[model samples]
Target: ASQQFKENLTLVATHEKKLELKRSACPKPGPGQALVHVRATGVCGSDVHFWQHAGLGPWKITDCTALGHESGGEVVAVGEGVTNVSVGDRVAIEPGVPCGKATCNFCLTGQYNLCPTVDFYSVPPKDGTLTRYHVHPAGWLHKVPKSMKWAEIALLEPLSVCLSATLRAELKLGQPVLITGAGPIGVVQLLCAKASGCSPIVITDLSSERLDFAKKLVPSVNTYQVDTKKDAKTAAREIVDVFTNAADMGVQVMPEVTMECTGVESSIHTAAYATQSAGLVFIVGVGKDFIQVPFMELSVRQITVSHLFRYSNTWPRAIRLVAGGVIDLLPIVTKTFPLEQADEAVRHSADRTKFSVKTLIVDGEE
Candidate 1:
């Protein structure tokens, strides 16, 4: 097959106002690669950030770039040396492709999320899967069950992120947990934690609408609506007191594990203060390069802090968990649009008042 496919809609950056949809040709797969018929591509927060800010952390956008990474599709063609999947097989593409060389410590340990040679899709100069068709390495594709919905399958990438963070926290069964930020990633973390056997999960967010949506997915969860402009430490103390039953135990706070999902600096500090002594604080949110952390308090409390990037060695487990009904991802997708309306979908994702948790661009729908 030739790479001269039709011009499809793609979000491009030019250090200007925002991402603009441009017409582009379908890219061909190289060795060990497969051409995927894009079915559903998710609009992530990072995608919005890249569109507005033109970069994330140290990664900058110097050229026109397609911005989407959470996606799923069917295999339309395979390059030479590809053996895992054939044409017509439904698969979820892991957007990050790392150099699988043995010399790389991250690859050797199967923790390729840390691999420096990783080429992540949707970042600068890397065309994402938002177009009609995309080509990716077969090694990064995971076959989806026929019974799974494309929208749910598209979520495997973000779920892998939550799984990685939860794994780093080393959560135990029946342990109380608190998650800051009730956004898509935060809700996904709640689901992953529940699947991992954590109990009494509590989540905090600024919007009551998001908290309401979260309640529908996790009915038994304890949620608190926070004022983003207020002092997070005071709010965190109040929440911790309520969870710890300070009225009975006289303890200041509780929760064995705290998963900070909001990249906001205040939320990070709040999570640190809210965590129990000798507990773990997993920073799942991607914040600025540096922030003032309460190291002295953490030292006295013996709190362990861990950070997360995208994900690695987690897709198989996440797939199995979602397949086994341990985690229901259907609720995460709040809206869907056709590929022609790709720009609208991205705009909806950028506006939180639209009550959009996850917006997927559907290329083909009956």
Candidate 2:
């Protein structure tokens, strides 16, 4: 209620590979919005990429803005018409809010993530929640139980992506699934597939440590490391062989679905080759803009390959999965840093050491 209370500290991405801590005016919640006192924010790969590359794909940072999207905090204030949340409620920020207009086909069809006018957090010119306070559409904020920690609540953002990918794959119980890459997304997909009753899920990566970490999370999950020196064609064949031979012993039974969480070209090829005919392949990772693949081969196999952007309408389910103990993300969070050390936090996240899985920037003790 005082002028001093209206100032917020923000971690701004000032330039390429640089972040500066500065004071910013706390934003006020407008109608249908809620002002959140951000408690913790996760350093995502995209956040690190934006800092290192200054942009992603065609989106470039046009201005100096805060740089975190996966965050959670308490609702401190609300605007008129906000009914779902109240002051003092803990919530996870969804980060993406579509242009609320009925004329848009994507929004009208319930696929708001595809809305061209959507403004996602930390995507170029947009300032993210890497601040002590933030304002967001109340509809995009999902409440969490008081017992949940802020870091865990913030992680729902990545989990939402995994859920979207799992949904797109049309995953079924007892179906075999293949996932490429042992990065955070791939690991999350592994957990989601396991919860969906997918049996004998296989994951591949370049790091044996990451693969071992995946196995630690789920002992039943099968992991393999890709040989970097091998030719792509040969590597793909070998990767596919593991999937086909997983359950039937030496019998060669293909997985019904493949979730390609690695943007690597070879991994994509392996995903296509490993899936059974009439199966689905979901490109879940963000990678190079263009890469050559065995399209004609996949065409003959009648496998469908699809790509998903950010999630839509998935926060509630993600929260349910974590709250119900169907998924545990705490193990994935390996490091934590305070707001003052935000720059170092992102840099650490960029490094894929044997122990680095997920990193968090906390506002305080949480």
Which prediction has the highest TM-score against the true structure? 2
RMSD of each: 2.5, 2.0
TM-score between model 2 and native:
0.94
Residues 36-129 of candidate 2: C-alpha lDDT, one tens digit per residue: 9998988888887777777778878766767999999999999999999999899999898888798999999889999998999888668899
Check candidate 2 and list the clashing pairs. Answer: none
lDDT at residue 278 of model 2 (Cα atoms) = 91
lDDT of 1 by residue, 1-366 (tens): 433356656666556747677876766789999989888888899888887888877778887678789898889889899999988898998999889998999989988988998989987667777877788989999998887788878889889999888888988888889999999999999888787787678889888998898888888788878876767678877777667662245654488899999988888888888888899889988777789888897899999998888888888888888888888998888888998888788889998567888888888862
Off by over 4 Å in 2: 1-7, 248-250, 352-354
Model 1, poorest ten-residue lDDT window? 244-253
**Candidate 1 runs further than 4 Å off:** 1-7, 228-230, 245-253
Overlapping backbone residue pairs in candidate 2 total: 0
